[model samples]
Structures are given as structure tokens and as C-alpha cells.
Target: MKVKDGIIGLLIGDALGVPVEFERREYLKEHPVSDMMGYGTYNMPPGTWSDDTSMTIATMASIINKKSIDYNDIISEFCEWYENDAYCQYGLFDIGNTTQLALINYINGNPALECGPDDERSNGNGSLMRILPLAYIKDIDYETVENVSALTHGHKRSKISCVLYIEIAKSMIENDNLDIDGHIKIACDKIINYYKDDKELIHFKRIFENDLDDIDKISSKGYVISTFESVIYCLKNTDSYKDAVLSAVNLGRDTDTVAAICGGLAGIYYGFDSIPIDWIDTIPKIDKVLSLCEKYEAFCDEY
Candidate 1:
């Protein structure tokens, strides 16, 4: 599994599902995105991606140019990109209310750390969705990844959730002999340690550590913890890249974003070859994503 291909697969999946993101299951059943041939509600031509891909690309671009995860740089790039309508189709759709509010606060002179909600309820999946680039950077220790997460997402629970997902993805990519159960146990332990006092963390632990077999039973809706857990569930249960994403996309709410996140990790685990070629061919930014991957791979080589 070349890491480049894994990244490419992620971009492809994100773009392919963007147009049909929130359509009901019945709607999809009638017009299933069975192939990456790219037909969906947005009525976009086959390759347009939503905020998922744009933010990820922004993250990747920051790492490539800065050679590290600089929070200020990422925010600047994100705002600049959004303002310039770089993500044209996605801008037409509503940005998350929390994100909009947070960005507004940031723009109005609030400290970046203080921009997001102080309450536990501010746990949207925005942070997790844009963190995949950290999974690709090289030589920087796990401490760097954790620090970067905290910088972008001030909430400890949100930071920890991003850390866990990155750790799982890194283990899969670097350790051929990685044990999934062992990885999950380690992640769960670390998450518990970080948010031991929080009730949401307790609830997350109960749902995550249980013997729940249904992927759909796991909530992939919108909360950071739930979305992270759902992605983990999809990764653990599915046998192939196709099954992993299909399972995630079929789960009613927040389907596209969940599938994109799961698809990115699964692509890394299963390798790019495991992803369908048709899907790769259909991504809107195929050339651009591949270029970034190549540049990232070169950067990894240097380190």
C-alpha cells in the first residue's frame, strides 16, 4: 500500500460523494453512487468535492509548504481559500453553524484557542475531518501530532479524538503487523486518560468498548466523539475499501463526511490498489491530489 495511493483514494472518495452528501437513503437507492461515475444531488459534473476535500487539501498544502502543521498557517489558508471560493460547490452549501460562529469569533479578535465553544457541547466533527495530513508527515514524533491537534482544536476531547484517529492510521500504515484490537485498546486508554472527568468521554467509552456488531448502530451523525467512533467501527468491521466506504455512506446522517473520513483511513490500511480504479479516475482533483501526494512522499523521503 503506497501512502501516495492512500492519499489519492481519499481525495477521490471525498470528491465522488460531495454532490450527493445529504440525500436520503431512499434517494440514493434510486440513484445509487454505485460507481464513481459521479451522479448526485449537487448536479455537479463528476469531480467536484465539498468542504471535506477542500479542508484536507488546505491541510496538505500547509504541510507541504511549511513542512509542519502550523495552526496559524492552516487557518490563514482555510480562510483565504474560503473567501476566494476555491471550494466553489461547497461554498454554496451551508457551512456548519458552529464553524461559522467560530471563524467569525476568530476574525473578530478572539484568541484562536478561545474561538470554539468552551462547553462540552461544542464537539463537532470539523476538527477530525481535516486532520488526515498529520497522518502523512514524517519524522515528527507523536508529540508533534498531539500538539498540532491541540493547536487547531482547543477542546481537549476534540484534540484527543483527532490524536486517536491519527495514531490508528499511522499504526496501520507503518506497522504491517499491527493488531487492531491492541491499537483500539491503547487508543481507548489514552482517550480515557485525557478526558477522565468528562461525561461525554465516559459515554463514548461505553459505546466504543462494547461488543456492538452493527456499524450502522454506531452514530456517525455529527459529534466529534461519535463520528470518530463510527469511523473506527467502520474500519474494524469492513473487509475491503469498497465495503468500508459503502458501509459508512449507507449510514443515514452525515453520510458523505463519515464515508470520506473512513475511506481515507481504510484506503491507508487497505492500500490504494484496494480502492476501485473507477473511483480514482472520477475525482475532480485527481491530478492535484496526486501532485500533493507525490510532493508529500518526497518530503517524507527527505526526513
Candidate 2:
């Protein structure tokens, strides 16, 4: 299944980035990551992933177990993973601030849809990092993407970025041969046209106009916009799936997230087989991932 490519590719990217998450690009210039070695940032053994994969798998489990994309079930799954450590090997190790607060809001009796902070400052990459499942979902729209994002981050910029990401992922699934630059242009134009009246929509216009080949000011941070731009930059600049994910990891801070997010796109465009088999074996709990992929494929078939 292409969803396997998207999810497992993302998990592999997350695992690859875990050991060197906070190291700067300049430092990585000296000691670059050649494989999925561990014991750097989080001090875990090799193959240990962070909240990026944890939440992603949680969401996937939610979709499969609930037999639908019910936001409440998804939120509950996130909570179960956060509090009960479901699907994660080492429990929750790296949750974003906004996600923590939003989970708290949910635990404190806030409506699942109303739990997230709507403040502009709350725009974060937490929700965006684990939103790949929606790409495989049937009959999804920008509003559904926003509501899902609203379970953690409620800002328009974040919601819009998620929509654009899902658009690219879905488009990639439909036409694997589509040119990446052209695909991005279509997604950007479609999103910009939909949200043109909003002044904030101008923030993503560069993605519409530029192909990221000449951009010298890329930031690899956890903020939603930076994460979105960084993922795009990595995808557009790299030639292969390996290079695309490596480019994201070497960009530094928030490495797992940046790579995981970019990996979904690279996986979709490059195909699942393009991901290195050695790297795939290096991930822990491969059986679980395989089972989830099977479940997702069967669910899609039935849907």
C-alpha cells in the first residue's frame, strides 16, 4: 500500500533523526549521520523513535480500531498514548508544548474540538507531524484537516499547512509521476486561491512562486510554518528518497519531526521500495508497523 510507504517512510525518517535531533547543520557538517545509529540526543538505543512516530501510530491505530476518523476517538488515542504509552516503545519522550497543553485541556473536560489553544502563538508542528493518516482517508476536506489539527493547534496557518501537506500527499498517491515542482505549484495555487482574502495566506505564497532551489534562508525549527517550508525545501532539493530524508535530518533542531514530515512526501513520490531495506530493518517493532499497514490497506479496500 502507498500508505505503507507514507507511514513507514515517515517512521524510518523519525528513527534516523532521533540520535542527532538538536545538532546544528554546521556541527553535522563535521560528523554526519551515515546510518540509524543511536544514543545521541535522547540517549536511547538504535531504532528508538520519539513522539513523532508514537503519535502517528496512535492516530493510525485510532483510525483502524475506531473504523473511522472520529476526532474524539483520535484524541482519546492520543491521550492513551501520552498517558498510557500505547504504541510507543519507551513511552512519551518528546511531546510539543501545544500538544501537552491541548491534551491537558481534553483531560480537564474541554470538548475535543474546543480543546486546543487558538492563540497565534500556539501554532506548532505537533499536529502537522502526525497528520499523514488523513491523506489516506476518504472524502477528507480542508475543514476536516483543520478540525483534526484543532485537536492540538487551532491557528489558521497550521491548519492551512496541514491541508496543503495532505493535498500534496493525496496528489502524489493519485499520480506518482507528477513533477514535484508542478505538484507543489498546483497545491499552492489551490490553497492560495481558497484563502486569498485572508492576509495570513500571503505567508505561503513563496511556496507557490518558488521551487526552493535558490532559497538560502531555510529554518529547520518546530514552528508550523518553518516545518512546512523546511519539509518542502528538503523534498524539492533532493534527488532520491534517502537524500530527501537525510536533508531534513541534517537541517538540525527538531530533526525527527522535520525528517518525518518530509519523509511522507518523499515516500509518496519515490515509492515504498525506494526506501532502503537496511534502514527499514533497523526500526524497532517492524511487526507492528507491518500489521498496521495491512489493517490500513484492508480498511481502505472496504471503505
Candidate 3:
């Protein structure tokens, strides 16, 4: 259950999808991505990743350096990366609209938690994408996950999505054989139980519904529900790490993010050994990624 296994696996997915980000599904069907590619959308090299990995790494560094879930540190790190191009290869080329707005609020001296918009439309996959690290954070609470998600997205749907996703990740990391559908059902039930008193369950109707029957509803859109369903769909349908992530990439439009999110789950379920060594080698700054993985492993043990 090495955290970096998921992180690097996610980066591979991000790198693979970066090139073909807005290509339609029909276009991708005709021109399938068989391997990690580059220089199409962002025109970067083969191993370069987008804001997904950068923000995920920022969240990881905040946990490691601060030894806790420090929202201030997380926002500061994100600003550093956004302003100075830190913690990424070839600099920050892309960012989500909600994230950009939240960072702007941070730059204007608003508190990190207050930065994100609270509207329903603010429900992009921005927070959900980088939340895998928090699943490995020691003694993390669902409130902490909510707070983390709120740093960039203040909607309840976004918070619930993070909480559920992290719970699923925790389940996979701790128990290899946990049935995906059953585990997800349990996780969703718990979410419903926990939040039942606070808000109507209708807002998160998608999370409560059976996703297998709603496979047609899944997509690579930037919406949190779409990403959440799409990731789970790819994981359920594919057996190997390669197949899971490639399935995500083929969804097209927001390809990098969908694949990255799916790759994170697959990496945990399949173990680091499941990831292709050639894919691992092709990623830029492989040594650095491995170093982070080691630190994350120790972090998990200590706390």
C-alpha cells in the first residue's frame, strides 16, 4: 500500500491523457492511445503531467512537511506552484477554473477554507482529483477530508465525493479483496448515514445510485460526479493496472484527469509491481517520484 504507487500510477495516467484532452470519444475510437504520449494539447514531452499531479504532489508535500493536514500549508504550496512553477515538470501549463479562482482568493489574503466558491456550479472534479494522498494521511477525519476539499471547492457534493473516494481508497489499501461494488455500497451507505441529518440525500443522488446500471452516464467531464463514476467504472471493468488507466484515457475529454484518478485506485488495488516498469521509467523525474513514495510509506508507518 505504498502511497507513491498510486501517485506515480496516477502520473502515468495524467501524462498519457495530457496529449489528447479534448478529443471526442469518436475521435479517440479511431485514434486510440496505446501508450504514454505527449505534445498534443499542451505540447509537452512524453512524461510531463498537468495540474492534477502537481496539486496531488502539493497536497502530499503539505502532509509530509507539516506532518498534518494544514490547509494554510496546502494553499501556500499551491500558490507557490502556481506562481513559481514548483513541484512539476515543464512548469504549470493547465489549471481548472475553480482551482484558479480559489488560488486567486488565497492570493488576495482570504483564508484557505474561505477561498473556494460555495455554489452548486463550483462542483468541478478539482478537489476530488488530488484527494488520494489524504486517504493515506494518518488519523485523517472525514471532516479533514471535507476541509481539504473545501479549500478549492466548497460545495457539499464536492466534499461528499472526496470523503467517499478516500474511504474507497482506504478500503483498497487495507484489504485487497474487498468487493468493489459491495465496498462502494458500504461506503456510500455510511456517507448517507453520516450526512443524512445535515442535507437532503437528493444532492448526491448519483453516489447513492448503482453505477453499473448507469454506465452510460459516466464520462470524462470535469464534473465530480462524472469523474467519480467514470473512475469506478474503469476500475470495475479492467483487470490490470494498464487496462484500468487506458480505459480511463480512452474516454476522451478530461482524459488525463479521469485516467489519473482511476490509475490511483488501480495502483493501490494491483500494487506497485503491477505498474509497467517501462511506463515508470518513461516518467520524468522517476527518482524524485520514488523518493516521495518512500517518504509516504514511512509517513504511513509513523502515524
Candidate number with the higher TM-score (1 or 3): 3
Go through the candidates in order and give each one's C-alpha lDDT: 0.67, 0.85, 0.85
- Looking at model 2, the pairs that clash are none
**Model 2 segments more than 4 A misplaced:** none
Each candidate's clash count = 0, 0, 0
lDDT of 1 at 79: 68
Model 2: per-residue lDDT, tens digit, 22-92? Answer: 88888987877778888888898888888888888888888888888789998998899889988787777
- For candidate 3, write residues 1-303 as lDDT tens digits: 688778888888888899999888888889999887779988898888889999998887887898777899999999999999998887889999999999999999999999989899999999988888988865678998999999999998899899988887887777767777766777788888888876635756765786354556667789888888888888878889999999899988889999999888888878889998888888888788778778877887898
Better of 1 and 3 by lDDT: 3
Which consecutive 10 residues in model 2 have the weakest lDDT in total?
A: 207-216
With a 3 Å backbone cut-off (N, CA, C), the pairs that clash in candidate 1 are: none
After superposing candidate 1 on the true structure, give the runs of residues whose Cα lies further than 4 Å from its correct spot. 25-32, 37-39, 87-94, 139-153, 190-200, 207-210
Backbone clashes, candidate 2: 0
